[model samples]
Target chain A: MPTDPKNPSGASTINGTDAVDSRRKPGAAEKSWEEKTLVPTLAKSPERASKFTTVSSYPIRRLYTPADLSGWDEDRDLGLPGEPPYTRGIHPTMYRTRLWTMRQFAGFGTAEDTNQRFRYLLAQGQTGLSVAFDLPTLMGYDSDHALSEGEVGKCGVAISSLADMEVLFDKIPIADVSTSMTINSPAAVIWAMYLAVAEKQGADWKKIAGTLQNDILKEYIAQKEYIYPPEPSMRLVIDTIEFGAKHTPKFNVISISGYHIREAGSTAIQELAFTLRDGIEYVDWALRRGMNIDEFAPRLSFFFNAHSDFFEEIAKYRAARRIWHKTMTERYGAKNARSWALRFHTQTAGCSLTAQQPYNNVVRTALQALAAVLGGTQSLHTNSLDEAWALPTEFAATLALRTQQIIAHESGVTNTVDPLGGSYFVEALTNEVEAGAWDYIRKIDALGGMVAAIERGYPQREIADAAYQYQMEVDRKEKIVVGVNDYFTKENPLDILQIDESVAHRQAERLAKLRAERSSDEVARRLDGLRIASQGKENLMPYIYDAVKAYATLGEICDAMKVAFGIYDEVAIT
Target chain B: MSEKRIRVLIAKPGLDGHDRGAKIIARALRDAGMEVIYTGLRQTPEMIASAAAQEDVDVIGLSILSGAHNTLGPRLMELLREKGMGDVCVVIGGIIPEADIPALKKVGIAEIFLPGTPTQAIVDFIRSRISAAPSKA
Candidate 1:
């Protein structure tokens, strides 16, 4: 007989076979409650829908109790903060000792213009610097390149050479502040620019603390700002990891990011699984490159997105730490405790912001920021209200900074570590996220690894399906996005930031002047040296460092490498 | 009556990779019985214009989120006009600021779709704007 999903095992068979049979069957009390209370209540007032689910489409149980986490062991599953399997948090005193770094990702217009914004945010109590490069800079092109037209200093500041990087941090001391650069594909080259600038500032590499978002896998997976194929790209990432482990003890080489993955319309669980799996791929490649896991793994940091789901987002961060801890110890044989801890930066979900009723975005951002804080994020970036319309205007960016400030100073959430640790619902959800992510890992492992899985379009297809499913839900009114799907409004237009048209002209002129003044022969020699070094087994960071120091523009160096390692064209699966 | 599908070229004209809006509109237009060509990301005005000309698209839809609309918007229009494709309907989408609307419209863009504009509204606009015999060549 075919299995009837509703009543697969007969009522008679549910009574006395084994523990499994008894567990599947509702208890006598639950059955009585369902028959009497639930049925009558439903008949009188029908439930809103046949089923309810989280934003990620995970089913939401009506109520959770200790029974939901029946087999969960406190020691094994929910160890104390700063311990192995740190589901509670990575640090013993997560926020009591020091709060998360208030980092606002701000970069637009010229280097001088963005430098001013940096000073303003720093004066307004922003703790860290996160650089957002313009399109040309992000894709390894000079400001004057044909592809860089109309895009110079539009999205983020355009930094084409060490000179621009130096101007970007004019008065800001690299020694005192931790900076995060959101650039990949050409991350190795861009990071070299930053290092050269720091060297000019007389800052020691070991003492300079910062993070480089050198996660090219995510670029191929979501961001699509890639210049080279995955193989050579992975080589560049490993080179940085090896270089950082040896030299820059304080700097985090790769911020394994799921922020863009979630922004590209992945479920929360997909974001978690794919991000950790990417981290695993990086670790495996590094080990293959002859680096010890403990040497590089401890410095590896993560970046995640804090979406609108409050409890779910909190559980994701907690579960990520736990999963990373277990994977490092059991799977990779990492002996150092710090190597097991997953330190991460969280940014409020830019995807969740609605262009309608733009003011409502402030509330949404506050809630998401609170979720990041409650989840024990090491650093945070709150999106501004006007972000969905344009890059945040100065006023809007200030308010976004204030969101993080209010959470840190005003809110009493920082008084305890893992304040929601004992809640049955939170604990249960944490385990569920871990279990779900492990299932994805197993599938990826079966396909050989993440690279093999990516080649076959596994995660990409999963995210696209999830995105389509969500849009359908919103269209069918199954899900409610305030001010978007429901609670409609005619948004009174807000003041938006407009990049000046002269930025491109000014940037091109600067590049032209630099090209005239710099030693062309030195640039050519450095680039050729970089090209030859890129083809060999030796690390390319030293060559990139030399090239940047010689004032070779980003495009020049990247084109040189392109000669050795050809450009990447994405396999279109959509 | 046999109707040729509305061939629309959708191009991302800047470095911003937030394609949720682009992908959504592409699918919506495809469902609405239009042939949409999606140029993935980081396309220059030159590349976009070249693609539009080669594809012989009746409509060119540009998506820009980087606030470079003032610079790129007019550049694309001029490039398209230079390519002798000025008759093609041009629609602009993504985080376009209100202050820049007059300038973009002044440059001959036929429509501007803000973030909240419905996908159906876009489909209807494209269908209504194109002439009866949209140049199939």
Candidate 2:
């Protein structure tokens, strides 16, 4: 076997093809052991199935030894935490310094109603705020718009104007707690409203810390909430990154998200590969926009999904960090260490939850949360048990928050950084995930980055195929999802929280009152200015900020921009 | 009688963006010898009712995850009635709180399918429901 003097694993090179080589081969002794000991045991009990594979379809071997990683270079591949490449972990101290932020996503009903929920969660020891906008707001429709009739304040909190934003953060200080808004399409406009609200709160823009899910690429590829076409949409994203880098240095302008992609039924490896590729695409665009790598890269954060696959999820995170480090340092020549680090927030998979035996979701979320913790996430949001049914009830959401607290305090996992870092299986799996992701990245690069690849429906088709394949497996009983295909039980559905029906009417009234009171002339002037700027090369942030300050509704501003930028018609792939 | 494929209009009303369930149902229906017209996401009740009429679909399936089902579901049923397309059997799915199910059914939502439901179950339900209806073709 090849040996390296420096590698802790006593292996050799960890770069290019050498790293892909298996370290040890089965000798006559192993063969005899398999035949004598393994074959007899298998004859009695037999393997549970003909084959075993991970959720991502990575075939599981009977055993992994030095043979599996014969040329693995520990130092080169798995470095110390907080070091270059960040394969082990991002921070040297990791959870020892502080646990990942327990940010529970909460938003429903009117702004005041959601504000109360936010306060309640904060009081219950939730660290940060994650705002889930209602359908009208998410789609950039006014509360009173014809299309938004039944959707106002339904799925999430409805914020149609700066007035609603002000109420949503009514007593909450903008400067103290970092907020993450799950908004896209009209992300620039929503972000401008947030800035206006912060200004109203008299908070320094530079001191505001938060993340905007301004990931338009993933929207097109997975989420299907896209408003503009690819080129102009990317331009809007770069504008925010440049603006955030210059002004709000503490804020992450674009949260390149794999959460929605995974929720849309992408395999773990696809989520990793496609998300990282999206991040790379953004960086390329920003670089081409005359921005330095280090200036904006540090502020760019990622959002990932922590699915049910324990090792697969953890390995995905580790692989993501390593791939990002290599790309930033070697590919982009990023000098800043922070630029090489891939800081990400993870949410336990909502799609993994089952409506039957809904309480099982709590257990599933705990395992997913543990995987995320071990994977060294910067932030986590454990999904509630009732999420599969509807918006989580208060009791369920509190229990979900308690899940994270238990992991942080009781689980004892936070005691060390990268506690499972040196495991042979984890290391081997990490390499496999990285190699798989690299293959996808190279394929995407050959197609001239994500935009071109998305136009050709590359990632979309891949996700759809994986989703269909998984469904087929589930249907055929090849996959045993508890309470789904196996251990089937017909139980009464659990009590789910229903959104108050009056929310839409109340929000519409609020919108009407605001519209009646606001200065019409000023709103018109700023909107005209915004429309003019949208037709030019000017950053849309300032113009959007101006229009938002004039108390223009989201739909009005988005409509004005639509006139200039036009809307995108999605090419249905599936 | 003319043999016609069961035309199902699967529209996601409101802006939940949770299309996995919708797409699964669409594909399943298509596989089960049905012409499934999926109108993508953020489709309004009006748009759905109009599409159901224009497409001459035999069934209208509304997949809504955004708790706006109580509002959107009834309104969509009403719109279909206004269009005199009451023959269009409406089915609702996705994340509907059980408490609201009675109200939804009262407003003419023929069926409700929650999560963890198999695609075959949905397909079977559509087939059984449509086969019972008198042929218009």
lDDT of 2 by residue, A1-574 (tens): 1222344231122111232334446567766776677666654654444445676666656565555666779899998999977988899999999889999999988999999999999999999999999878887889888877777777789899999998999999999999999998989999998998898889999999999999999988888887778888888999999999989999999899999999998988899999999999999999999999999999989999999889999999999999999999999999999999999999999989988898899999999999999999999999999888888889999999999999999999999889998788888888888888999999999999999999998998898878877787787777778999789777887777666658888888888899999999999999999889889988889988999998999999999988877888776655
- Give the CA lDDT, 0 to 100, for residue A26 in model 1: 57
The Cα error of candidate 2 at residue A10, in Å, is 32
Give the poorly placed runs of model 2, Cα more than 4 Å off. A1-24, A27-29, B1-4
| Model 2 chain A: lowest-lDDT 10 consecutive positions | A8-17
| lDDT, candidate 1, A400-425, per-residue tens | 99988888889889998989998978
Extract clashing residue pairs from model 2. Answer: A23-A70, A24-A67
Clashes of 2: 2
For model 2 chain B, the run of ten residues with the poorest summed lDDT: B14-23
Which tens-of-lDDT digit does each residue in B69-116 have in candidate 2?
877888888898888988889999888777778988888889998877
